[model samples]
Target: MAEAASVTTTLYYYSIFTSPPDRSRTSSSSSVSVRRRNPSSLSWVLRCSTNTSFPWGCDTDSLENASALQKWLSKSGLPPQKMGIERVQVGERGLVALKNIRKGEKLLFVPPSLVISADSEWSCTEVGKVLKRNSVPDWPLLATYLISEASLMESSRWSSYISALPRQPYSLLYWTRSELDKYLVASQIRERAIERINDVAGTYNDLRLRIFSKYPHLFPLEVRLPAMDGNVALVPWADMLNHSCEVETFLDYDKSSQGVFYTTDKPYQPGEQVFISYGKKSNGELLLSYGFVPKEGTNPSDSVELSLSLNKSDKCYFEKSEALRKHGLSVSQQFPLQITGWPMELMAYAYLAVSPPDMRRNFEEMAAAASTRTTSTKDMRYPEVEEQALQFILDSCETSISKYTKFLQGIESLDLDVTSPKQINRISFLKQLAVDLCTSERRILFRTQYGKRPGPGSGRFTDGAEILRRSLRDMRNGELRALKILNGFRKLFK
Candidate 1:
């Protein structure tokens, strides 16, 4: 997957009002009133009106920026291709087909000189030398380099590319801590985002104290601050393409051509928006990293990590803890619960944690073997204790589902008109994503609990158990179809 770059607020916002000429051309009558509130401080509000042509309310600026960027690319070694930029529902500016393009056609061939990579030599040798001497990693180094160049405006060689980048990237990195806490309380992504934010801030502070303050001549204060968080690259025209879960197109470096290229595997109509796959990322991941979520039931790669911990009151708690410690395993661990199935490691951990007193003697050996050996879902079964493990897993899934349900109820009660439309949409998407994960996990548990029936003609068969097992089996089979479809879609992307 191509890593999405973070936008430098200082340069990004400046570029928004300076280079985008058409932004000033919008008529007052058709403009929509937008209340722009600072994420950190709500008291600092900026009232602005945006034209309705852009669904995201920044159409004119994006169109102008795209136009300027296209002209620049045309002069900077971009091939004369039948592709152009246009406003799209998914993103502010997206590359669209200007003419009919056939399958297997070469859509874009961006020269290496135009691509902004961490490996590329910096224009400012002094600053570059400092960065290289300190062994700064690619992400922060590139982010700082971008800020330095962007601060120069027209003097910067990559000014045109910088100007085209979105002023407000929809990434979760830009979300305020308060906003994340409020809207993403029940989701796991919130915790990850908070950790990332802290890491970035810590990195920036460390550099400032160690390098920037000592060598102010080489590293200016304006450029020293960290602006990006994840692995990033600036692929001029290629960055304009939006993402699609169904698309097989991916961006890659062509060593032979010494440039970036993306080949089309499917034909596109004259006005169709060109899409590239950002990778097999789940909706939760997409929303956290890219600031958008795919439609429900569309992402096959989606899964949630459910936390499992040992029961404190269990009779064999001390024995199990000691065994887990020897194997360098914790009593509490996270397990990936996917729509198709779960990892065998999860079941192994569960079995160790919930094993009875009689089986405690073998826990050390079992834990040691389990840690080193590969176990499949079939091997997860321990007939003597299968029911207990299944019950524990079921309880965890139920608890998660209840939390998500509560969040959904809270969203329903909010006055939509008073809240930011973007916030509302994001909150709703997250709620649905959580619901989907919980539902899938619950289905798997149901299968484990009731997919099998009592042996045929067994006199012990009760009416209630028989009916319950039959109903569960039917539902389980139906849910399995969804998992099959998801796996098939993933194969295409791979």
Candidate 2:
């Protein structure tokens, strides 16, 4: 995700243009419109994108960047490898096996010298010295380092690597606020996306106020990559590997080789595409970080968020709010709901929300159980509020389903803003992505209600957890004493 931007017309266009070969960091004539010769290499796959259009990087379908990156890495001490970058069906462009890659065989011995980190030498010495002096974190430092090197073009050692980065990485960070609201209106993921965008904006503003404004010439607005994956570092050839929901292997330092590599969990034919795991990420998570959503039911870890709120009319509202606040929760909370199960914590929160005055004694305990911070879990059941808890969840599920139903039925009606063909294409593409995400998410909610429609006269409220005949227990985050996870997917069969 190298944002190789030079001076732009506006401060926030966030373009990824390659500057002139002159390597001047402050030249006004740096931003060019033509494409450069992309190098060959086993460059990593940058799974991110942008909403604001400016020609920054090449198309993912093209192999010019990959080829260039490969040549550079090969000459720069990269070991012989069984895989090389190729056009693929899964992640657009990914590492494909050049030979029979076997299960358990470690791959991609990307040398330590090639990996980019905070400690990597900056092309701009002044920028590096100033950033380190301020005690910047690893994420922003690496982002700044990559941007600085990128601005230097061929003069910088990482020129080939920078050239390989996607001009527009496809993360939710790039999605416009209006787009998120209109497209992802049905799911709670919209909230997460908004929060993430705000976080990036906030970070950018903070840095501009503290550092970038003072050294504008050295740091030319790298707002995209920093918010991405605080836990991650930029790996070389390993970045080319695309994510598969099935694969359990991930890129990590191999102490034996003193470099980064991932062991193959599954066998691949010579021509087959190689895959790696991003994490045990849900469909919503993949969409958040990487723009793509997994096809329906293919991702075993796929899940949707279900939001639950305290009944304001309840007499214990103030007390419950205080208790939840102490445990770092609020009156309204979100829990992940999967096709197979729901977390026990969801049940605990629901119970507390629906608990009557008679169960006042256990309010604190229930709130504590709901918090992930609670090390020793306390699983308590209130038979008196059990039915109420189950109904509460079903009601919430119904409410969510209605919103999805409204959007899915006539999604095109929401695209009235498009006047030009370009705008139409953009809006339509975004709509399709939204439809895919919403459909997958709504599918889970639909399964939970046992064919229950949104309004009154819907199907009979299905049992939840122990009380929820099968749905609640089916989707459990873990084993529960009274029931299992909410098997929301099972609702479809009914």
Evaluate all candidate structures by whole-model CA lDDT and list the values in order: 0.57, 0.66
- Alpha-carbon TM-score of each model against the true structure: 0.72, 0.80
The TM-score measured for candidate 1 stands at 0.72
Q: Please give, for residues 372-478, the per-residue lDDT of candidate 2 as tens digits.
A: 77764444567667666877889999899999999998797887866999778767767877888889888887665553211111111222334243534543423
Which candidate has the top score in lDDT? Answer: 2
Q: Please, what are the lDDT tens digits per residue for candidate 1 over residues 1-494?
A: 00112322322111111101111111234221111111111101111124211111122236876788789889988888788987777555678899999898876778877777666666676777787688776556766676566545676777776666554444556566776776666666678767756655676777778777777665533322333332334566776777677876666555556666667879999999887766676566666556566665677666666677888899888788788778777787666555544555665676677688888766875566445342322343465665455556666666766665666567555545547887777566544544453344444334433433222221111122432234444556767998999999999999
Candidate 1 overall lDDT versus native: 0.57
Candidate 2's C-alpha runs over 4 A off are 1-6, 9-55, 220-232, 416-419, 450-494
Clashing pairs in 1: none
